[model samples]
Target: MEVISGGFHAVFPMEDGSRVGEARRHAAQLALDCGLDETEAGRLALVVTELGNNLARHAVRGRLLLSPRPALGEVDVIALDEGPGIANLERSLVDGFSTAGTPGTGLGAVRRLARQFDIHSSVPGGTVVLARVGAGPGPQEGHAICVGAVAIAAPGERVCGDGWAFALQGDVAALLVADGLGHGPDAAEAAAAAIEAFMEDPLASPRVLLAHIHQRLRSTRGAAVMLLQADVASGTVRSAGAGNVMARLVSGTSDRALLSQHGTAGIAVRTPEEQCIAWPEHALLVVSTDGIETRWPPTVLAPLLGRDPTLAAAVLVRDHCRGRDDATVAVLRRKD
Candidate 1:
């Protein structure tokens, strides 16, 4: 079975009811792009519409993230909001439970239509709902770990300069997050080049893979890159990086910040070093570009570490992103 990879590719701001139809149309188009039949596409549209309406009507500041998982032949819809979280999440999922008056079947219908559904909400903090809709066979066997990410270009940019990729071999899984020097076509070229080289031989140690990516990125502009290789059988993670890429490992009540050398790939790579860290049974690993603020504390993610990897990544981006450069966050966790 193919391992799942990639991030939320499109974002639609759901500030009001006016954008619901537009988001629904975009979701339908993405469903068709994933090769779903008209029935499946319609299902996806309804999910988007319902989620969008919730964001517009009740939530404070909200948006919808759409991830086209072509490998799974599905699309992931993530609804994110700033405040006014559900007072009673359990009751809200019922067919007739609504804080704002309308025959409240939105959340219940979304759960019924989606192939998979998960949600996390905080009273004053916010809420995140993940729903996947598709027509293809769902997640298959041999998925030892879960990986999800969110990479988006800076405002006004046509394409994102940050990129992420992952590879699985036996009990080991390798993940990469790269941010080109600047935000534009050239930066995107450099970031893409790094990913291409990393996948060429992902089984290599993180240090070795960084060297290879450094060489492959010589022609294009350089980038900040971080790689993590986790061995579930051994319960260890080896990480290597350069430039401003950031990584953190969250386990139990605490989280540890992973280190990276002070040099950029391709342009000025110094002697790379591999750092091996113990991987807790339920540990969660998050890697991101400088586009995300690095000063955030662990408590920000403490309540969300156990949620869907993609949803966690999206929350990080929504709250901590710097908004000045391309941002990307890749999440990894051992499957329960």
Candidate 2:
């Protein structure tokens, strides 16, 4: 079985109150599947209900994502909305603060019940909240690498053309992000094939892995692929890619772009060249498909880079998405 399992996503339109219960049921089930005791599962269910209700009651377009990290024994609940953003975040988190005239205890309860919590909101930019609950020691206590990712299909499509996966062993990790040539089932199939190839031999060098994926995808529709490898002990990152997928390494106040070469895997192809860069302590690595605008200022992304990886990925998907194609954002950070 995969290290991560029981992941689910739901979009709750702000038009009605039906999706709140749906989100709650899904989250409670996922929490149980991740091995949370009854008490912890109940707390997670409450967190989802509060967040989902807020979305149904207030936001414009909102979504909820629940993913289990079985290796870490945790479940992550993420809520995203493009609505009237919270103006006074600190006050909103205080108990008894309510604009909708209800109990006003939702945000406060979410903060109190979750082991890890974070929220970011702004007018015109919308809001993203993340809550994590788990049974064992947290990822920060022992994990050498922590990864967060968000993948979404186009507004009307049923399957996302973009795909991503990662493998971790000891102090090293390998990551892959693939964007099939177009959107829909064919594209998704191509991306899935690439992921299967990646899973078969995840520890290969970036160039070698990309070549293998290219070979595996020859019968499919083909895709743009990027492979990345990071060595925590040496503080280095190596990346190789083809087509328009973007990669960047951010450290402190600065950001450096990692370039991919021309060509598409399994179609018009080239011998991919791996690029090496220094990854300083606390630096973050972001890999995303072309669906996101690549010119975001470092200042705007600084705060997100320091947040939970999943929340950070969601913020990028929410703020920078082009909305015309499948979108994906993946983040990697060293916990120490």
Candidate 3:
């Protein structure tokens, strides 16, 4: 799906009642945009508010991520918080995990009230509430998903085995893209494993996250990674990466690559160094596995500068991954 031309982001502080109320309003607006009925929208609003409130009462802070489902036709929200990570998944789902244990019904109520609910949480890793509106898991119509583009990791052709993690951490959306060694199954597994490790804390610095992944991947394979965070509101982008993976921050015709002298993702252990640029809301941040490196056309990236990041990235992959190995294109678009 595309971003509302004006750009969409609303910050809500933990435990701040006003912030919770504002988040509910924002959730409602998003629900309406997703074709949700009034009642559905209200329910979604409540779900979001409840989740946000829980964050305030338990985690460092909470963030609400709005994006289009695979089908641009629908909208989805991912409530993010690495706090008070649920100790028990099944028990939490059964409802009543509250520290204060009030009505002990938020989780069950949320499940019964929403159209979709997919939750991922680890006791030490916090929680990410992923929910969708509009439709369920089925073949969505139209070759064109409302988003800009769509693509997948093809077979045969050599491609970078990198997966990316993006979330609004603090003032910027932290992006972590990791590429494993060569291509094929082993590389894919390596990259996937690293992604899981880094995602434990998407906001961690490049070096820290890389080190974490390295130690974890030791049992398996290793990888190379490029981590970047851009604060469009502040017009700044910071990036660091290892291995041969490349990241380009596009500002009009000027194409610049992000480079790091450190080791690879599964092996790095150096001080993180980054380059900062005057990022623009309409600027393009393109990242991919080596399989699809530098193959993106300037034209495709130009119009994608102000669109939904995931959508735009999908389009990039769709167009370039024709005969490639596992390929991933992750784009970050800022709004002015």
Candidate 4:
């Protein structure tokens, strides 16, 4: 089976009131582009508008990220902010409780509109909210796999250096995570090149795919790249990497790190070696860039591994991110 993964879409800034409308328009268009009906698109637009308004009204700096899951006919909306976190999340989600003196229904409405919704916030830690809307009722029970991700630029930069993408063909799913050598436009260019290369032939082995990305990115700034392929029917995962991108497979109470060799992809890389690991039923595969703190104690990892992949990615980025750089996390779980 061949799977065509959705491309990495644009990221919208919600810094001021002016950007809120832009966020709404961008999300609505993305929903339509992903094959959502008009009704679904409208609901998504409204959710975006509400989240944007909340950011503008309360936070110092914020962004709305739009990622499409074409395989499921779904669009993911993630709203992240820097400061002035909610004081009372429960009250904020109440139907009529407003801190800005408006209708106070933004968060409530978003929950109602989304197929899946989650929010994490703290007074000093800022906020990250996730909402996923599907074109239809969603996938049937016992789907082979479910994948979700989040990528954000450095606090002061407009483009993120980290990027990720996935594709499924039959029982196999291939995932790519790339981090450009540094932050900003040149870095984003390198990451984008890797993504383009992966999409060109997503079903290739991880080593071959990374080799192709290395060739395509030689002219630009180099990046750290990792490719992971899961064979659901065989209950196994194969991985290859060049540089600092990290991959891990997590079961109910155990975590296994999938190591990557040292050296940049487009710069200096040795022959890539693919590593394979057993993936138990209901286990999760997580791939992330150096921007995230890799050494999490079991205490920190336990709660996160149980949530939806989107929310798990969001929480990990929210709690473990190294604020000085661009951060990204992608989570994949085989459905039961």
Best by lDDT: 1
Query: Could you give candidate 4's per-residue lDDT for residues 1-336 as a string of tens digits?
Result: 434344443567777889888878777777777899888898888888999888888876687878777667889898888778888988888899987789989999999999888887778658878888886666433346777787777878877888888785557788999999999999989998998899888878998987888889999899999999999889899899999898888766677899899989889888888888898776779888999999854344454455667767876776688988888888887754
Runs in model 1 deviating more than 4 A are 1-3
The collision pairs in model 3 are 1-147, 15-56, 72-146, 149-314, 149-315, 159-291, 160-290, 160-291, 224-265, 281-334
Give TM-scores for every candidate, taking all chains together and pairing residue i with residue i: 0.94, 0.86, 0.52, 0.78
Query: Any runs in candidate 4 off by more than 4 Å, and if so which?
Result: 1-41, 52-75, 80-108, 115-128, 134-142
Worst 10 residues of 2 by lDDT: 1-10
- Roughly what TM-score does model 4 have, to 2 decimal places? 0.78
Q: Which ten residues in a row have the lowest lDDT in candidate 1?
A: 1-10
Clashing pairs in 4: 1-169, 1-170, 3-168
Ten residues in a row with the worst lDDT in model 3?
A: 1-10
Ranking by lDDT: 1, 2, 4, 3
* Candidate lDDT values, in order: 0.85, 0.81, 0.59, 0.81
Cα lDDT tens digits for candidate 3, 1-336: 112111112334455556777777767666666667666666677777666666666665565545434323345555666565788777877766656756667666777765666565555646666454554333222212111212244454333355555555335667666666766567767877876776677666665765677688776567877777676457777777777666877756677777766576555556656677776545677777665656565666564455455445544543455455555666665443
Give the clash total for candidate 1. Answer: 0
Task: Report the lDDT tens digits of candidate 1 across residue range 155-246.
Answer: 88878889888886657889988899998899999988988898778778999999999899999889999999988999999999998999
